[model samples]
Target: MTTTRSLVVPLPDTTATCQARRRLDELVKPVGSLGRLEELAAWLCGAHGTVPPRPLDDVRVAVFAGDHGVSAAPPGAPGVSAYPRELTAAMVRVFQAGTSGVTVLAREVGARVRVLDIAVDAELDDVARDVVARKVRRGSGAIDVEDALTPGEAEQAFSVGRAVADEEVDAGADLLIPGDMGIGNSTVAAALVGASLGLPAHRVVGTGTGVDETGHAHKVAVVERALHRVEGRVADPFDRLTALGSACAAATAGFLVQAAVRSTPVVLDGVFSLAAALVARDIAPDAARWWLAGHRSTEPAQSVALTALGLEPILDLGLRLGEGSGAVQAVPVLRAARAVLADMGSLADLT
Candidate 1:
């Protein structure tokens, strides 16, 4: 005869639990002591919400494209407004053509690309039936003098992103990839990232589209001035986003919140995506846990944002292009993680 006693033990920290087991195995001889690979495997387990995460059925990429008003002020031939507005439409075509490196790579992995027109300047014609249409505004206001977007516009963008994520989750997408395609968008990302870290633009800014030294310097100065302008203001996530963010950033932040609530993973690309992730995390801390930094970008603010969030990038290919390319690159790594847990032989089986 046996008697059972009622007892409760709190669950171990998911992150630690997964890591400890892998580290223990790696400590053994022969198969063990393979450097940090084992440690990394364990970390992946926690990020996947499993002692050993397995293959997900479907992977989808959501690219949120928009334009920036600051482009209007750039001292140049085409002018800021002329450049971003037309380029936004062209990039959308590149995405639609399935010719972009990101689109092609994702297709190779059987991942679907869902392009969302969060705030592009041009109208998309003959779009693939699959792309998501969610334009909030044509472009943002110049940050050199005024707020990027009104509070109401920011809220609307967020709402659209949430709705898209909810709909995708309902359609069986377990993981989401949020990318952006907007000219002069990096300026907006720099502003938001700078504000979050309380750093001036000179530190957070980076070259976009191979800018000349003078133009690059000018961009940095713009970021610095924007930071000073917003000083002592409300640091609230939504407020901060509206005042300084591109439509793409605002929308991605909202999508991240929905991803957390749905327990779906988000693969983030570049500085803008990282900034949006940070803002979304502020809205919902659990969302940070759901994020996987797909890669490090050439942008300086990206590393800072990743560091502040305590996230390690899955890949460090130094990718600066932000068409969801990084996310597509990480899909294989995620799949490999699932394979290790689900298919790798147990010690007993090997014996």
Candidate 2:
């Protein structure tokens, strides 16, 4: 766990006069045509309480996983047919081995990967090493049957997530990557997003790990039923997350809230992760100020969710892969942003 003591100083105006002047002199034609990135650099200069744009160094990805009780639906979930909660635990172990698809790519980019078992049926193998096992419950209630998570479970999930973020910050993590790995999480993700954004179930749902058309339609129907079950209190994001969210979304929301308070950067993955980010943003709109959309997911609701957050995805790549793969893939682009600000020579010297 990483913790840094913060000394709040009266807001100081740290202007990038030299940097702006150099940009103005550059041959790019416009003073700041790159929009958000240019603004981001300027904002970073001010937020640094100094100049020269020192970028964040310690980057970590927190991938939270859980099992959805609703995954047991028959005739619809024709694939596994049994409880998939064990599969969630299995994937957590795979991620812990540092050889999983995501960990391999994450290691390449120097990003430390950590897995959180928010809720699952089976206990993980190596409990102490790197996997965070803060189980909220065995699994969420069946979506079509009842509330996914009770209010207490929802709050507990969020508290655990916040504790994780606080610990990560204490351990020197400068930037946070919030991701998820529950087997049937996409179902809960779509239900939550659809309810929050008031989109139709058909519009919000998508295939998770390759389901047939019948399964896809059934997924939408289940989400629609969940929406009906948890209606009337749309004002509270936490309420929405708890009632409709997976443990992963609850955890991710917790991380986003803590990062916003600490003034750390958060890289958001696709719709599932971003739905949690949205929950955080709703609670504290300022939290969004620290968000960077990592990539555009092939999930249908992803673009709508990202646009709703006012974040532009850095990469499209036609990627629907979860388990933080897309977000890890975009790390180099963020590193590139830092390199441009830190290493690129100003036009004054070039001329």
Candidate 3:
């Protein structure tokens, strides 16, 4: 992540984290018997400033949908995705219809899904106002040849994300998940992370959406071109985002920044979310304390980014599908952490 202005994001409550660990150890079970569950519980405690974090009663996921210019080519071409570009808009409608994979999984975990059209190529005016109200442009520019977004569009996307986080937190969402929905967004994510971490294009590219070896190589070449375009020129996180990230990525980064400012805990989803998180962390170093690496994707760039942020994945399910599915899958595990802290009996209870 590029070093920028460190926002006044506060660290989690240390007293609460200590109390939570002590309480967990004093439980009726053996010390540390719960393994990582205890660690998750303690992190939640620090996030909420309480020994027993309030149950994750309200979980909200904001999927930022946009289209990439690099993906303008058809399938099997450089910078293009296996899926068609129309899938971005089609998936938005599917998400609103509650029939998407993420929606169904969200239902099982008692979480809510909200889709935002940040830079979708099509006019989603027919969708809910809340979703399309923040559209900065139709689609982002081809990063391989031009900046992904203009300076104005990048700023607007970031503002939209910050506003959405406030709206969710004000609506009583205790936990937030930022997901991505854009064709070829994986390429955009990799390019941004490659720029942020000063890595070569080959090191950051990954086969998103089940690409074959040839397709993966094509993606790598495309990302390499984009990274070369901005190498040694953009050092600020925001500048890197404008150079290499999609509209949805900038929005996700903004959403992450505001969540930390609001002291809301977040479960990061996939390479897309982690890519944004790396940028967000650069803007606010302390914001890392409020985020949990929801799951690890198969992307090599994701592991590198997560390690750079000092976050360990809660689950390594080999999940690559974005739209916050993996993060929501780990929500039940977090809920269990709260349950263990709130319901598991202690020796005092036995007495």
Q: List, residue by residue over 77-161, the lDDT tens digit for candidate 2.
A: 4531123555788887888778777798888888898888887767664664445457777778787777778756676777788
lDDT of 1 by residue, 143-245 (tens): 8788888768877888777878888889988678887888887788888999988888887888866576767887887777778888878388878887788
* Better candidate by TM-score, 1 or 3: 3
Tens-digit lDDT track for model 3 on 258-297?
8998999999989999999998887777888899998999
Q: What is the C-alpha RMSD of each candidate to the true structure, in Å?
A: 7.2, 4.2, 2.4
Task: Please identify model 2 stretches exceeding 4 Å from their true place.
Answer: 1-50, 75-85, 129-133
Best to worst by lDDT, what's the order? 3, 1, 2
Cα deviation of 167, candidate 1, in Å: 1.7
Q: List the residue pairs that clash in candidate 3.
A: none
* lDDT winner, 2 or 3: 3
Judge candidate 3 at residue 222 and give its lDDT: 87
What is residue 143's positional error in candidate 3, in angstroms? 0.8
Alpha-carbon lDDT of model 3: 0.88
List per-prediction Cα lDDT, in the order shown: 0.74, 0.72, 0.88
Task: List TM-score per model, in order.
Answer: 0.87, 0.87, 0.96
Identify the candidate with maximal lDDT.
3
Best by TM-score: 3
Residue 295 of candidate 3: its Cα lDDT?
91
What is the Cα-based lDDT of residue 343 in candidate 2? Answer: 63
Model 3 poorest ten-residue lDDT run: 1-10
Query: Which pairs of residues collide in model 1?
Result: 71-80
